[model samples]
Target chain A: MLLFLSFLAIIMIASSHNAESKVHEIAKLNNEVRELRTHFVDGKTELMRLKMESSIVKKMMQKGLKRPERPPRKIIVKN
Target chain B: MAVKEKNILNRLYFIAACMFVFAIAVLVKLVNIQFVEGDMYRQKGQERVFKTFDIPANRGNLYDSKGNLLATSVPKYDIRFDALAVNEKDFRAHIKPLCEALSKEFGKSVSYYDKIIRTARSNKNRYLLLRRNLGYSQYMRVKKFPLFEFGANRGGLIVEQRTVREHPIGKIAERTVGYERRDEQGYYTRVGLEGAYGPFLRGKEGKRKKQKIAKNQWKPIGDANEVEPQDGFDVVSTIDVNIQDIAHHELLAQLEKFEAEHGTVVVMETKTGEIKAISNLGRTKTGRYYEKLNYAVGESHEPGSTFKLMTIVAALEDKVIDSSHVVDTEDGKVKFYDRTVRDSKWGGYGKISMAKAFELSSNTAFAKIIDQNYKNNPRKFVDRLINMGLGETLGLAIKGEGKPKIPYPGDDDWYGTTLPWMAHGYGVAITPLQTLAFYNAIANDGEMVKPRFIKEVKTWDKTRERFDKEILNPTICSKETAKIAQEMMKNVVKRGTADNIRTDNFGIAGKTGTCWGNYGKDKEREYISSFAGYFPVDKPIYSCIVVIHRPNKKKGYYGSEVAAPVFKTIATKIYNDIPVIDEVSYAVVESNAVVNSYDKYYQNAQKYKTIMPNVKGMPAMDVVALLENMGLRVKLEGVGKVKNQSIKPGTKVKINQTVRLELS
Candidate 1:
């Protein structure tokens, strides 16, 4: 009985230590996720700013491309 | 000697008794300490080793209606160095390269870092700041730099990570995206959607019990957490990124050209009342413009000529005047109790129709018409506006919405000329958003819908709440009154004040408003230029308003010159993006060419099952598919129609036989 009780205590300690490591791993992973999300948002914001209509117009002016005078027309066929 | 020995024996017995007393006293003290003081000492030890740690929950992200990220919480790092931990040898060996790397990363001169680092080392400053508030990628790059690569113990690098709110679109919609921050006193300062939905965006914090282990690390004591944290729910707003971008740039460009003090633009969906874009820009001391405050939703001032729509609608609803009722402008000015109202046109439109009076935006004309109709009982006019929900607050989700002040008949500010002044949009004050909502109601055929910012609240994939189109009033006026008002606004763009802003492709119905502002007892008056309207006069989709405050008087102050152009730019952008569909009645024409080709192709395929057919005019691709499907290998040369085939027509085709087709 004494040996079994000692064995149970040892197992409990080992499992608790295992849980501690797992917790640390989860914390690290969460930090990584936050870092990745920050990068994604930063890149997306840059892309949106670059692709804005004003920016595009400014860029295309050097190429002598101006906005269209009339809107595009679509023909609808009724069958 | 005998006597001395006997005395010594007595001394020995006395010494033995003293020793026994000392031992017994020590035993009693040990027992007292074990039983009485043990618990107190054990608790003190536990206090040093055990701790309850708070685990902060991540703030939720904010997204646009199309799921584009607007705001999110990101970890920002602060890097510090411990000068004392570095030995002279390691410092000397790595300092030059480390300084070079830092200079390259932070865009500073290498000598500047070298001097600061040397001064810090000489002073033995343990916590020397290297960089503050670096993004995650920059922090990671800095962590791999020469001295920092060795980490805290070897290289003396100290890094502190903090979560900060980041806006993806940068300054485009900064004020609307907003932020939430807490001080040491636990008081929160919230702004915009971030502050309005703080409780939902800031989730519950969790707690964990931990114990101190080796190397000063705290290990969680149990497998289960004491309390689990709930991450904040994401808020989906109604802003369309494209429209917001256009509104921001156009407003910025106009404000800069006019050198105006500040301006705001709001675009709303007519049917749903969803705010697609709201931009407020104020000039800075350095001559740059930014979204300093939400002027569109928070600044209330006299709406000038835009308010005439409300007055005319009220008059028409009361059966006071028809669209063709004639009004005399008395040349250019008219006199009231103590004040005179003048039209911008030197010689007035003189005896024009009431609709033309609105189209010309004649100040004297509106003043004369409204005062003549409602002079007997002024409360009837004010009640007409109040009944239209113009006097009430919009109760927007965002904080700091300016309250509209429309003076009543018995109010202290009311006077003899107050009705005429209010009729011409001077005595009353309304925010740009309120005016937009009123115009939106007209575009919606008199059904007023409340302006909404947030569309939904979600946690990961689960939706917590959804906000729909909220009806503030089922109908503010009769359909007939709305139609008359809409027609008058359209006439303004066509042949009136806003003629310059009219487009050839589509129709825009709106009013131009230019009013004198800041006219105190002794102060000089400034002009506030504004325009409000909806597009595609026949079927309106969106309603927009642009208000520019305090434009340079020397350049121009009229609404048509300063504000209407921005509205036109935004409207034209939207118009250019959408394609116009032209529908025609379907007509079927019989063609002999198609029938002939179909008959020939069908007959040849049906007759040449086991033999190769002459495919002279047939396209190369169809010939290959035909020959290959018949279990014969097809080899093609050149392009276009098949000129010749090796196999003769009506010849038997064998399996694994190669058929060459020449094409041109």
Candidate 2:
């Protein structure tokens, strides 16, 4: 009878441990998806900024606008 | 001994019975766990492990009829935080650097970020939205931030994909196409073409079943449950982008030059009423062409002389007057009630043909004719106009088409003077498009057609569903009446009020309109000047209208002065750009010289001149008088009526060299 009680206790312990392992695994996957989302957000913002600038530059070119020429600079001492 | 043996046997049976009961109970419990109650635990297991997430599909792209991209959907992302994943003690310690990083990434203040984070954590929102519509790079930088370096799910940060609307054409036709807004009903609807055709423009939303592994953490189920989204169909518009650009540019220039309160330029294909270009420019309070009001469809003022075309058509249809029928224009003015209708000038034009009356825009002659024809029966004329499809909303695919208010004799708004006032364009309101459509019907051989903007709708690949033109009526007038009306309109551009619109390239025929607007705000009677016409009078292809509203005196307020030139400007370019059925040919009508006095002028300057005699310093009245006698056109231009001429005075010039005369 004592042996049977010991075996039943062993089974309960094993099942509870399995449940714990499962919770850990779910946490790990949750972390992965969250990390991926952050990466995606950063990439999107950079793309939008670049695209907006590119469109502006393209419009300027279409209007036949040229870059402004640099003027000669004179050296000055602190006054 | 016998009792002991019996007791042992009963104990054995009892033990067997107990064992059988235990075995049955165990079997029943296994069955319940394995089948009947299995789903409950399975659900519980899923709650512990699986997660669901939304996958936002891309918004559809909007394209022009020529497949030019007008609007499109670009992918964007939302940044979020999962407060439960990080330890509460460490959350505060890490919050400052995270806020600083987010501020730098989003270019917002650090305090704003800090406040959002503190509130989010306090609320215990597992996934709190930090910022939406972040670009890919911004999200990546946020992900790589030192405190957030731990992967998203582990570090309690998230980035979700979404789509943002973009206008590829920018503000071009922005008001017409319209926009989408989420209304109070929690439903999204389109405002313009974007709104009207939104169902066709917005692709169907896809669905997915996902498991929620942790609070606010979801992962998509098997591919079987994930539905692929169908993209929205594209709307192909009737608007030609090139022509639209030209109209926008030209209308802006005219409005600026005229310093007008507002203006609209509409170009429609004569046969189909397929609006090719519609440009509406309104001057801001600062007197600049930057207002967004759609004057073409919204403004419903008395169309004035432009509406005279309808009266004339009605007259021709009733056979009240023939093209050559002559009538004295009441010596310029006639008293009808307290209101006196005049032929523009106070004194009446001399004896003129019906065609000449149309050209000169004799208000007295038209009023007299309308009085004679409709005096006995007003309803027939009103019904005739209604049959021609005026005074009612066109029910165009676009919304907000205003209904015309036609005052009838018995109606509450009608008065005895309504006929005369309505005769010369008053006592009623009609939009620019409605007026154009009426003239368009006349030009289209009396066939009224529904004006359309969206020509075709398609999928991403051009599997087209072409929209056939809606022909509302076969003919509004008899073939004879139509021909007579066409000739009358032709006379308008040839020798009438709009004669200055004549170009060497194409023959134009239409009407000029000038009317007091904004309730005759000034006693001096400033006017809304407009010209509506179609080109190549022989086979009409394109009809256009140019309206300049409330121009200052410096800009020339007459329709013939301000609007006619804009019509010419646009028509000339269209004729040059688009191929027409017939090539322009000016058949030289040579006339026998009444006197050869100009022969010496041509003979002396023949060599120095490029081709023909340059009649510089010649009086325009005399030059036109002589040229019309000799069958030639005198292209006049400038302020004091014929200043310096383009060709040297008295220099022989080629017929092709445009003779520019300054005219005040």
lDDT by residue (tens digit), candidate 1, A1-79: 9999999999999997888689889999987887898788677777877877888899999999988777899999898
* True-structure Cα RMSD, model 2: 18.8
Clashing pairs in 1: none
Off by over 4 Å in 1: A72-79, B1-47, B82-98, B118-126, B146-157, B214-217, B223-225, B520-522, B581-664
The DockQ of each candidate is 0.57, 0.04
- Evaluated with lDDT, which candidate comes out highest? 1
Please compute and give the TM-score of the first chain of candidate 2 against the native first chain.
0.56
Mind giving the per-residue lDDT tens digits that candidate 2 earns over B68-129? 65566655678788877888666767888988888887789999988977787788888888
Candidate 2 accuracy as TM-score: 0.63
